[model samples]
Target chain A: MFSLQGYGPSILEGTYLTLEISFVSLFVAMLLGICGALAKLSGSPVLRAIAKLYTTVIRGIPDLVMMLLVFFGGQVIVNKVGPLFGYNEYIDINPFVAGASTIGFIFGAYMTETFRGAILAVGRGQLEAGYAYGMTGLQVFSRILLPQMVRHAIPGFGNNWLVLIKTTALVSIIGLDDMVRKAAMAAGATRMPFTFYVAVAINYLLITTVSIYLLKYLETRYSVGVRRE
Target chain B: MDFAIIASNIDIYLEGLKNTLILVSISLIFGLVMAIPLAVLRTSGNLYVQAPIRAFVYFFRGTPLLVQMFLVYYGFGQFEAMRESVLWPLFREAYFCALFTFALNTCAYTTEIIRGSIVATPHGEIEAARAAGMSTFLMLRRIVLPSAFRRALPAYSNEIIFMLHGSSLASVITIIDITGAARIVNSRYYSPWEAFLTAAVFYMAITFTIVFFVRKLEKLWQRHLMPLEQLDTKIEAPSI
Candidate 1:
């Protein structure tokens, strides 16, 4: 019962890749979400329209299709354009970039919604008071809106992150050796789909459980300044 | 670059859309029916009953729907007993599998959302109903679901939009929905940009339409509260 068969290595390796993809994608999405939310909230119409388009398109398309289109379709674009620029080498999108970019781009839309709601939740009174005391919009945002927005946004952000982690399972279809794909491979090799898939489920549960705890900790820390009564 | 193939296959795409609609509508209706009972169970305060419902919600909501779909389809297909069993005919159909998963998944989310709304119904109203010697079932039927429908309406609308999008995933497992049609076109023609972009535009249009209806429904349902809310909002607006 305790035999370490063909399953262990692939599962472990896939776990690392999944974690790497998730972390990098989440970081990129956060930056993108913040910038997108700020752009939408910006006073300029052009910036707002652009932000709106980004979020709307990402939200509308199914995550699976987007991943396939970006991974397969992006490769085509890259290959076509590559040979035109003096030197042509066969450059393919590594599973990491494909996985990370797709997940990040999609979740960035969700995170934009989270951040926008949180920013709006930050009372406008404070910003007005800051303005009365000669604070600029940039100063008001950084010194006032940003902190409260982060706090209010934590739970929603946590939810989005959880969904994002699960969506990464789709990446396995396009040859990213994530936990799901690795388990599928192991299952193929070992002819035990149930056992391998169960292992994949556990891997996801582990990652999700740990992330929830971290999000909880961050939530508590962020609430410190505002919860003083 | 060849428009003729896609142009000629417009009928296939329409057929696919019809199948997608059938799957979505049936699952959503069934999900709604099941959710009401499950919501009642969840809020009943009997640990023996509520515990299982809680567990079911957590298990379903905590996991991705695609995993559940695959588990039902491929995972269960692994069992010869399942394949040959009385349920085999039903399970063999991708439509049934997708609908089953969609219904069950949406039920979990909807049950929680509905239960929250029911619980949030004014205690005064419940007391008034009970004070009048109303039966439990009667009170729930006449008072709870009706009132809770108002509160849950917003969340249910969100779920509706989500399920519409979720229907797209059914294509992955050979359901041949709108998304399935798009994939078929993409592979044969290698025009990923047009194929996928067209699908995205269609989905966006549908989502926008659903959202618009949800907003209208919200306003209609909340008509009585609007005046008070508007007054409160007006006061808060200038202050904010």
Candidate 2:
């Protein structure tokens, strides 16, 4: 009968949890990505090597494996460190923190590539002009490099964002009470798994649809002065 | 940290690797086959044919594969008709459910990648084919598809790797792929680092192998597009 008798509020809460995880993870990802891109671009060999190793290994493995390792393995490490610091009680790792950081770390590798390409796409002449106009290094970066890099980065960023949003669903596997988990619970209780999962699926589609539009709007907003080919 | 656990349990890991490989290869093959027509339809200039396919691709690509797998494996059973249907036996198996979800998920991504390259195929080449008295079918077969595939190779290779990574989700439905193997080891020996890191190493090996072969294939396919001098560096043709 496709009935939803009593699971509406919990499902809404799950949706909020999903959104909160996604946004927090996205912020962390962007921060790591910019740092990674800068490190790879820097002249220091050690920085470049470390960044390269991180991106290569992170990109090579599955995110689910990363999630499992971070959640459980991280707990072991935290507990190990806790007793050493004279705090002997077991420290429970929050699934939210574990899930967000893992997802953030995984996508940071991808975003590094996108940001690197975007940075490289900005012309050297433009940076030189900024320098010639009595601009400091930070001024050159903020004024000349940042805006154009964002424009060039938007397509790849949009792609990464879409994937990142979908990737958040994996957090449920690690026992986060996200929308998918909420749906599973509802499905089990109501014995209408189809309806509940479909509900989750529809919510995801709606979010993605809205994201695509919002990304397009940002693209337009950033592309204000540029002429379209 | 516990290397001994992995060393002692290598066989179980190998079994998991085998399952992962089977799931990835079968799903990739099926997904690729299904994707070709969908890719073509996706780019067709008609709305009716394109609309539904676009919706299908969007729905699949927009949601998580984990959800799709759950919807198929658990959700399908909710319907009385699906349970009573003749195909229920096949659907009941966890392996089939995983395979079906993986195939459908990869098909959506592969379709978009192929469609992008198909649309990107140079218009001038199509014109040349048409001018050479080629029919539409012949043009598509000889020029369009080949050129499209060549252009698509890089992106398609990424999709293959993504699918390989995605195959880990089979563990969620209890199919026991590499990730599942790691989970088992983690639960048993309580050494998460050794268990998942071992599986991670296996994935990295597979990923490197794919990247190596794809790079070689790209170089081979791109020969004609490269300048003659760059094409045969060893020959060192006379300075001209």
- B107-191: candidate 1 lDDT, tens digit per residue: 9899999999999999999999999999999999999889999999988998887788778889878988878887888888787
The per-model lDDT (C-alpha) reads 0.83, 0.92
Q: What digit string (tens of lDDT, one per residue) describes model 2 on residues B82-138?
A: 989999999999999999999999999999989998899888998999999999778
DockQ of each: 0.45, 0.90
Q: Indicate the DockQ of the complex predicted as candidate 2.
A: 0.90
Off by over 4 Å in 1: A1-6, A125-143, B1-5, B228-240
lDDT of candidate 1 over A1-229, digit per residue (tens): 2233767887999889888888889998998999888888889999999999998787677787788778878888888888899648888878678879989988888898889889889888988999999999899889988877888899999999998888878887778888877877776776666566666776777788888999999998999876455
Residues A1-229, candidate 2: write the lDDT tens digits.
5666689888889999999999999998999999999899999999999999999998799999999999999999999999888999989999999999999999898899999999999999999999999999899988899988999999999999999999999999999999999999998888988889888999999999999999999999999889998
What are the runs in model 2 whose C-alpha is more than 4 Å off?
Answer: B233-240
* lDDT of model 1 at position B136: 92
